[model samples]
Target: MTERIGIVGGGIVGIAIARALTARGVGEVTVLEKERRLAAHQTGHNSGVVHAGLYYAPGSLKAQLCAAGRVLIREFCQEKGLPYREVGKLVVAVDDTELPALAEIERRSIANKVPRLARIDDPAHLRDIEPHVAGVAAVHSPETAVVDYASITEAMAQDVRAAGGTILLGHGVTEITVDGDTVRVATDASEHEFTRLVVCAGLQSDIVAKLVGADPSPKILPFRGEYWALSPDRTDLVSGMIYPVPDPRFPFLGVHFTRGVYDDVHVGPNAVPALAREGYGWLTISPKDTWESLRWPGAWPLAKRHWRMGVDEISASLVKRLYFGKARRFVPELRMADLEAKTASGVRAQAWGRDGSLLDDFAVDRIGPVTVLRNAPSPAATSSIAIAEHVLQHHLDLAAT
Candidate 1:
């Protein structure tokens, strides 16, 4: 007998799981997407850089999965003739103060076993990799690549369909109920029944998880990351991805420059507290979403701790010059004029605990047959395939059988 499976959210993670399950002949897979198209949210709006396991702690799920996922995604992209470019990445340390953090990153990268990872201490050698980038020292990850994740998600959807799966677009999941051996998923248009359900509802993860009677302690706090495209003339300034040594105090990777698969360079993605879960721009607001964030027990404590950072982020968001200044740290040639226009922004569904702690690693909760992806931010797209394998083996307990 075929086991029926329902997956909520059409992002890369959910679609990747669907493809994996169908390939294994585990069950009949059906993907439910709220939007008219797939990858319309975080997956679409992301910077599309494939991480090389540089920042995660050693032995953590993120480190394990990210390292494996990069290889898997590269292979998948090759097999599908997708656009995958190994443009490389340099984690630059500007001053002696940042060198310690940069060294720590190197240690973590070594522990993660990132292939072809090299540390460059000579200033002249550092300039050889990225001539425009200025840094005292740098850790270069040559394997770090970029691809169109939205296109990959679409290809995964195609594989799901070819393997006898169903994909229903614009089907917003509103409720989930578990009744003994079966699970029922309610959407705006209709309802679905299956033996198992997986919720990968990115921005709305908390709400969707709660609908299925999952814990709501680690609430989702949306952080809008706005990007700026480099002017066509200045695009030549960046050869590849040039990033700063991330501040240990914050979870954000800080503002950096990334070259896309098409060879266009982009800067920024400054993290700011978003007013709504789906807030993509300054003008977009949701009163209810704002109230929910404000009312959460963790919200006040989190605000108290990070208020200064929050104020700084807001100032940068409001002033383009301030934002450009942050990115100019690595590339001194970058001017306010180089920031031509704003690009698409993404809202990260960052999870926060009642104790006011940010969940840094990937989190998933399983309540009976329902598996909820509570916190899956950066590297989630890069680790989608590995995450699917981990979810099936650990969370869903389907690998052994």
Candidate 2:
């Protein structure tokens, strides 16, 4: 008898898994999404950059999967005739102080075997790469590119449908229970019974995991990343993606400039502790979400440790000039006037431990037939395909089973 599989969350990761399972003839695959459409949350609001395994640590899942996923996504885009542009990326160091961090990043990139990675030290050559960028030195990854992840998610959903899977939108999973060998998933609209279940609830991962009696130590803390698009006339200032050498203390890549697939330029995405789990703006508050985050055992200590950075982030969110000044460090020509209108913002579903440490790698928890993706941010979109494969091979242990 074929096993029935149920996947919660219609984001790229869940959709990719559904597609992978259906293609492998694993079982009947049904995807449950709370929203009316797929990719409504993190997957939709992302910067759309296909990461080249430059920043991840060597031999890590992120490093392995990102390198592999970039190839897969490129091939998938080519095969599907989707837009995949190798616009390249520059991880810039504005002064001598940042060079050490930049060098460490280059070392990791080399260890990860990122294709066509080059170091640019001469200011003249840096100008040749990014004409307006004011960085003293940089590491260029020519293979870094951008694409519409929502489009990719939709295409994967199409593949799932074509392979005899079902996608149920507007079905928010409220609970999950085990009954002997079968798993029952309860949504607001209905209950689904399946032999196996996978929960990829991005922002609400921890909440969903608890429904199935999973540990809640690593709680989800939403970090809202606000963005500003450049005026149409100023879009020419950035030919490709320009990023800062990420601070070793934090996971955020810092504010930078990026040219989208549609030829528009955007700046920022300053990381600030969100008021709620899905909070996109200062006014969008959720009392329950706020309470949960604050009440977490780890929240206080974590805040105490990073209070200064947190203050800076929140200040930048409130002060447009301060936010613009960050990007202006590398893009000297970028003026406060160049910031056009506010664009759609994204909330990263970052997981934090009770010990006040942030969870760095992709975390998967297997409880019987239920597999929960606890923490998958940033490169998760880039690593969706490979993540699906890894889930199948390791988490689900399909072959052994």
Candidate 3:
């Protein structure tokens, strides 16, 4: 194995891949990150809830990896002495209309092979688990956890470095060309050649894939997920995570309650179109980003599809009462005063097809010397280790030959 594996992106996924490749003693692993530090984008901005593999369809990559990733993540956290907690998640059906969907979710969880999942028929049982939540029935997924993903990413980078791998910061890859047996990567700083390339460039994944002469087909539509942290006095409004039954038509999970690893309760990560790729707030907009959003064919279609939902989200975003009111539906005790405008937003690197349909599964495409990840979201943070393994098994090993 005389090949060097060049990875673009320094987010958690890229860091995990680098670490995994290094541990395998795969010759040389070079990670080129555009930022000064790792996890500067989506990895650092998320709600920090490790997924429980409950929401995705059975047999999909998202379901399998998320279920397996939970165990792997718990073990990794324990081994590394990292901070994490498997506090569990509760998906509530507030009315009879949602029970069928809730049951389907439970069935899907079983199919995904997640452990400790059960249906709570009695409101008393729901109250015992989540005292503040109001629901007729709920699905309890106790394997879900929360952690500082940035910390995990940092540890992965350290492991890569210790394994004689190079992490190049502040180096944005500008161009890529495949020669006979080598791939040349041109960055803003310099150029390097590698025997293979793997791109996990979070928000820039589609663009980076294009640079490698791949079909650059999936368009990365960045959706800003904004959160509201509960005021310290009102932190007891809910225990663990309390989620609503998601809209089947949409790719996003509805706004829910998240108790972070830091002990703060987060609410309202409403899916809204972002003005900038790295936009974290209502006012954070870029000229180029605005231009891109205006021109993306999927933008109008997505907006049209989610028009009413988008209007409601914008209303919630503008009105604090409306935002807290939504949260109050799940946890009746939560008040408007309990909410503080602790604004932190994550950019979901959502891949959209040319016809404007949202891709709902983990996408991996390999062409010649390059392997691309076009759609990696939600459980991507939870499933990163497994995703790395999957990539290595399916793409890297094959590309090496």
Candidate 4:
């Protein structure tokens, strides 16, 4: 019997899976996206950096897939004539206080076999990489890159279409049912039945999983990250990407500077609790989303543990000076005027368990004919293609072999 496949969400990972199924001739494939356009959410709103195998724990899925996906992305850009910039990245320890954390990052980088990874202790060498930046030491990944992820998503969609896969926009999955060997999915406008179903429903993963009668232990927490664009004239302050050693206690990387593939410099992405799942700013609020989050058993524990950092992030979001202060720590030359305007912001669907601990790695759950992605943030865009292959081989079909 031929396989009939249905995919939820039209983000890069979802589209990539559709494209892979088509390429493998795995029967009829269809992609459902809630938005009218692909990559309308996290995929489009990301920093556009192709993450190297840097921060993930050794032997984790993130570390493995990121190493593979980085190569695949560069090659895809070449074949599709999309812009791919290898602008390098420096993870700087701004002072002695940050040295221990920086060393752990270096250890991970080397264990992950990050290409061309280097450690610099001399302040002058750090300066050579990011001039006008103050740091006691640093770990450099010179092959780190930036690209247009949304464009890449469209390109993959083209492949899926070329292979006769159907992609439906604005088709949010409203309900899902499992009957015998097939999964039935109803959307806002239409319905589909497939031999197998894969849910990559970014921010709505939990809701969709609930529809399938799956465990609801891990809930999606909306964390909005805001960015500021550097004045075009002063973009030279950043030649590539300058980053801080992330706080291990939290999943967020601190505010840093990045030169985008288009040569625009952006600062920030401080994480704060978002009132709505899709909230992009302070004004956007959803009572249902907020109340659900507040009442979750994990909410208070998570907040109690990180309230100080949350306050700091919330403070930074409300005041430009505080945000500037974070960025200023990386680049001493960064002026208040240099941060010209607020750029696009993205809300990450951070998955937290009932215990309130963030899932730090990629997570997938299989419920008979349906597979749901519970936690796929950050390195997800970088690992989209690999993620597709993993899902197809492990979750969707195993008997074909």
TM-score of 4: 0.99
List candidate 3 stretches off by more than 4 Å: 398-401
List the global CA lDDT of all models. Answer: 0.92, 0.92, 0.87, 0.92
Q: Model 2 residue 207 lDDT?
A: 93
Q: Tell me the tens digit of each residue's lDDT in model 4 across 150-177.
A: 9999999999999999999999899998
> On TM-score, who's better, 3 or 4?
4
- Please provide TM-scores, in order, for all candidate models, with all chains considered together: 0.98, 0.99, 0.97, 0.99
Q: How many clashing residue pairs are found in candidate 4?
A: 0
TM-score of 1: 0.98
Q: Against the true structure, what is every candidate's RMSD?
A: 1.0, 0.9, 1.5, 0.9
Compared with the true structure, what per-residue lDDT tens digits does model 1 show for residues 1-401?
56899999999999999999988888788999999999999999999999999999999999999999999999999999999999999999999999999999999999999889999999899889999988899999998999999999999999999999999999999878899979998899889899999999999999999998888878899999999999988898888899999989888998899999988889878899899888899899999999999989898988898899999989999998889889888888888999989987999988999888999999999899899999999989999999999888888767855
Question: Which scores greater on lDDT, model 2 or model 3?
Answer: 2
Residue-level lDDT tens digits of model 2 in 207-253: 99999999996999899999999999989899899999999989999
**What does the lDDT read for residue 174 in candidate 4?**
96
lDDT of 3 by residue, 1-401 (tens): 48889999999899999988998888899999999999999999998988988889998999988877777887888989998888889999999999888888888888887788998999999999988889999999887889999999998888999999999999999999999779999999989999989999988898888887776568888888889888888888777999998888888888899888989888968888888888888789888877876687777887788899989888888888888787888888777878887568888999998768888999999878888899898889999999999999988874353
